[model samples]
Target: MLTRFVHSGPVRLWTQHLGHPTDPTILLVMGTATQGIGWPDELMRTLADNGRHVIRFDHRDTGRSDTVDFTTHPYTLADMAADTTAVLDGHAIPAAHIAGISLGATIGQWLAVHHAARVHTLTTIAASPMGNNPGPAWTRALTGQPAAPDELPPPTARFLNHLTASAQTPRTTHQQRIDADVQTWRVLNGDTLPFDEPAARQFVEHSYTRATDLTAATNHDRAGRHWDDNRRAPLSAITAPTLVLHGSADPLFPQHTAKPWQHRSRQPD
Candidate 1:
């Protein structure tokens, strides 16, 4: 694996590449507040072994990437989408198969609709059709506005409660922050799957130690409030072949959230 920093205009994004440059490229975009390493090494190797070049990058304010002050340099998802293209440009890749999860998935959708030529195929996991607009509750929290009548369902009460509790709790010490991350993943992993606490804790520890400013990751949530893209087109505008994947146990986005994407992409549910 090769890791380096790539420039996205004034921002610098930390990126990693696996597999030969000659192979078909696959760009992996992770969720909100997640760094590039959030894509497990095993998964990257599996894709590389399958005859594909894989790339992953840290979004601004996460991992080793530059952190912007929202007060002075607030940016929208469109800017994030541009950052994605900058990764491609830096690698001298004209296009690649795009795969994203959660907020990353929403960025993939935006790329497919706006930067269609840069996307060969699109795969979205645990995401809503639109950006992080996770229904009425989130809408109220972010924008102080009620959601449209047809918006997707809100996240589960359990998940919301966990978020609230986490926010209220202090994590001033390194160990406390590590513990918080482990618990956060436990909630996200849900009850259906085996909760690998040791592995989760190890990963969180590594991430926390490697981060330039761990708390700066919260800028992503703040960025959501400043989202001002009025030119966002519908999903039907996407011409790339699409696959939508959603877990039934996803606490943030319910299974029903995938229906609109499936219908729009003309993919079987």
Candidate 2:
């Protein structure tokens, strides 16, 4: 179900509405460069069907949420975390079962660690624990580029392909479903249809600029600079019940990289 969300910013937030009203809340967080619609609806449905109230919303710079000028300040992950807190507070949700993927997953990681009071159980898929992975050499190289408005399309396509491929692969727990989803999203994202290249580019530029400097290097540098120059605080502070999920074939975040997180996760009790 698609619901109308007009609060929070200049542009109305577009979110997915599903499941029964009485179900417990499970807020789904989308990854970087992706809208909540990119999240698999079945997953939310299943959670709702299992007596959980599932919800997903677009981040400020993604989907139909309000867009801002990223050229002014260096948007840090911490700032993104604050936006999430505001969203939750506005919805009157003190805390809920939280789940996220990739950058969304990273946000969840930060939420559970720094803002534990705001989240209940936590689930992170295809994510890393910042600085733990250090990422790859090429990953570092990519982040070093200039973050201009024009640098949106190709990387956007490549990143989407990666997420689509990761969720649809050999021996995946949910491949057929993911394949259909990829097709559906492709249709929704097509230029001739509803959301075209311009929309896609806008979403990409928004995310890139929001969490990084206007003149910030591409995401590669955003992460690489942090990995090499920054010292990430430990996740040992996270007390929330946690679950970590990753695909063995994921090129961006391989299965082995999940080990660092496994050590810190409190059992979901």
Candidate 3:
């Protein structure tokens, strides 16, 4: 795998690519505040082994990408979609299989609708057709109302702490950071899958070290709140083969959340 930075508009994106250039491409777009490194390396390698080019990148406000405060000048889902296009443009990839999770999936939706020619296939995981439910927590956050404990922020202090501890020069507050990573994954873990604390910690730590800006997650949430509106074009506009994958026990996005896409895409659950 190679790690590099690609200029994408005002912000440069941190990218990782695996597999041969000749292989079919798989472009992975992660959810809001989700680090590209957090994506399973095994998955990338497996796809590469099967003769697929796997590409993943950190969004503007995540990982080694440039961090800009979005509070003063908010960006839309369309802007995010363009960022993906910029990424593809940066790599000179004509077209690729596009897959995203949650917020990233929503961006994928935009790409499929507005930038159809660039997408070979569309796959959304743990996402709603309209992006996400937002629910009570995110709703409150957007409205400037006091958020409940669960809805504090996507990239919580604990998550940052864990990232800090995962650095090459491990901090003295290592235990606390490790604990944060353990708890964070525990909360997001689906019912069918056991929480792998050790693995989770390692992944978070590695990503943290590689990240150029630890506060990118916080900035990502700002843009996320601005575009949290449940918006989507008619499913008929989507021409590529589409796949919607949602975990039955996903705490953030329940099965009902994925129902719209399944119903509209005419794909069986």
User: Which candidate number maximizes TM-score?
Assistant: 1
The candidate with the higher TM-score, 1 or 3, is 1
Error of 3 at 199 (Å): 0.6
Candidate ranking under lDDT, highest first, comes to 1, 3, 2
Local distance difference test, candidate 1: 0.83
The per-prediction CA RMSD against the true structure, in angstroms, equals 3.9, 11.7, 6.9
Candidate 1 accuracy as TM-score? 0.89
lDDT of 2: 0.59
Instruction: Please list the residue runs of candidate 3 whose C-alpha ends up more than 4 Å from where it truly belongs after superposition.
Output: 131-174, 228-230, 257-269
Best by lDDT: 1
Residue 173's lDDT within candidate 3 is 82
TM-score for each predicted model, relative to the true structure: 0.89, 0.61, 0.77
Q: Each model's number of backbone clashes?
A: 0, 3, 0
Over 92-178, each residue of candidate 3 has an lDDT whose tens digit, in order, gives 798999999988888888788778899999999877665433556445544456644322122233433443455544335856655
Pairs of residues at least 3 apart in sequence or in different chains that clash in candidate 2:
24-53, 143-220, 143-221
Tens-digit lDDT string for candidate 1 (1-269):
99978899999999999999989999999889998888999999999999999999999988889988877888888888899999999999999999999889988998998889999999999887754344355656444455444555566667777888999878888788788889999989888889999999988888877788887888887765554443335677789999999898887776544545553342212
> Model 2 over residues 127-229: C-alpha lDDT tens digits?
7664354334334335554333211112233444555665565543344434443443454344433445454444444444333232222332343234322
